[model samples]
Target: MLIKVRFFKCGILQCNVVLNEGDIVTIWIDPKRVFLVKLAKGKRLDTDKGYILYDDIIGKEYGDVLKLSRATAYLLRPILEDIYLDLKRPSQVLYPKDVAYMIYSSSVEPGSVVIEAGTGSGFLTISLAHFLGKEGKVITYDVRRDMQETAKFNASVLNLQDRIEFKLKDIREGFEEKGVDAVFLDMPSPWEVVEKAYEALKPSAALIVFVPTVNQVEKTYLEMEKKGFVEIHAEELILREYKVKEGATRPKNVGITHTGYIIRGRKSIKTS
Candidate 1:
């Protein structure tokens, strides 16, 4: 996949470059330090190691190693997890681990009418839009216009603007659209919107809530039960890393231990 590379000076100032197909490039200024970078042709990127000419990487594939002027080498392609964590988030963004779980648990697919509340930095919105495709619709709501605008910018950047609908209304009252396949709640008081979600979702539709605290999770769970939801389940994901080297291969002592808990349930379908 073609990608753009951003070089950081002292881990602050950034210089961006684009990489074309079959490009081999060093992504880090210091070979010793790990950094995210892309490959491109006819571009020269300056680094402490040396000037890395884009031509050097023109024939390399993704994950290929490229050496700098000082003969120091770094990885060429950006990992999806790295890109998701490195997004420009002006608000609390959903972590990739949670996103993966949500997408899997919700069973979101093409042509799914997914409704998401509180478009916080558009991370989840982008993920959902990508998974939904052209046949799907992502109706996202944020009370703040600024947040909506930011999300719109992010969606456009990812070429997912067409699949998303940005609404500036508070979803606590209720969503205007009906017959949604799934509902994802990322707001502070998701319990307050349970009824709204129930009303908007189709019978047997999935409802997933993301909350930072167990208290919120418990409250949301009770609300779902009270609102006639079924098959309720909740889990918190803790991602640990393993250092894979010649002799060392163990879980990282400290990794992203906790982000939030996800509570999921389905609205019960009435049977005559």
Candidate 2:
């Protein structure tokens, strides 16, 4: 099925009018499955469920149900979770389960200035920007320019490009921004950059690290203590889904576990 399309930017993110040509829309199949597409005039998207015409999507408000040739789906705005799960991953990322805790522990909020290493597809970088709102800033560093460019593109998709400053350099060489509210490291050798993170953070600010192995967590924790960080702690998160069939309710046999270890601590002022 093909039809004509129209569009207008309603608000900062989501709006009521149907998506227009060139608008990026997420076709939500389920929590675990979603399809993203840039709607264009007279274009059609073929899926296992059915064929979705770009014209049929234009001007439909989000949350409206659409009837495809084979199935029904929801037209909706893509949230941070959708972006994180769907973006092209050139490197591993901190999933929402772990990222939530990291953001909470670091106390990232509106107007907060934060630093992060190894952008890694910009999952965490965009998350921080969402948390900081318009007044805050996120300075993220990555050694590879290609990865940084990918991250920047993802930020643009989320309309958060202005909230982040991407630096194509090694964070271990030291940071250009100082006294930041928080510094987060998602690199393989987070311990190597702990001192640099320490120097970049303000007194009482947080330093958070995410690593997949216990060895990395141990080394990072020790380095945090040695670098004058206090209240150091480490944790891991496991998420399970349950089959809520009313009469037959139980935990799903498959679930998410052991994504990574989060180590956090606070920088303290050095007294003479």
Candidate 3:
């Protein structure tokens, strides 16, 4: 497998450094199993093949492999998906399947200011922060302080605390940002805030809503249309996995069928 080396800024001066303790890393045992570790000086990780001391991994470079008795562990840099999937959060997250599409359909990229509602697990917020890079910012709002705390902690784990601004306010009340590039809604009552989202976004900016039920989708879509949002669309994403072998390959019987419905629309430049 090809290896890539990555570096991140460490301090106020923004000096780059190698991987260190508390940095999240991916240890691959095989094609099927991988482990996410936060390197600490005194910690130990025991796998089926063998145990590894954190001291051995704390200062090691990414893309390096440590050979154990029974398996070869490949240490690599962790991606957004890797960190997100391994997260232990109390709230239900937007899966990778949904996230990928949401980013694509909404045209979220580097240097785009984005607003996100209902920061449940911070998965989506993290992804937005990553894609926005250093040039852009994510303003995520949530009502519950506890949930916001969870999301804030997750952002800190990935060293993205500065990129996201967490707002502990109710969306129904209103949003702080105006003329933003895009808005993402993952809340229970997205329909209730469509007008607010329209006001927050810049003209021609995208308003994307993720809902779990068809009724919510219907209500949100109608609200967008009634509120004069153009280019309206609603979609459901389904993903299936397949097990492949040299001669045997088949789709997994059970797959991710329906996680949520996405409602997308562009803020209308024409107003009645």
- Error at 86, model 3, angstroms: 2.7
TM-score, one value per model: 0.78, 0.89, 0.90
lDDT of 1 at 15: 26
Best by TM-score: 3
Q: After superposition, how far is residue 166 of candidate 3 from its true place, in Å?
A: 0.7
| Worst window of 10 by summed lDDT in candidate 3 | 7-16
Model 1: residue 257 alpha-carbon error in angstroms: 0.9
232, model 3: CA deviation in Å? Answer: 0.8
TM-score of model 2 (CA atoms):
0.89
Off by over 4 Å in 2: 1-18, 30-33, 40-42
lDDT of 3 by residue, 161-265 (tens): 789999999999999889899999999999999999999999889999999999998999999999879999999988889988878999978788889999999
Best by lDDT: 3
lDDT of 2 by residue, 101-123 (tens): 99999987889999999898899
Worst 10 residues of 2 by lDDT: 2-11
Ranking by TM-score: 3, 2, 1
lDDT value for candidate 1?
Answer: 0.76
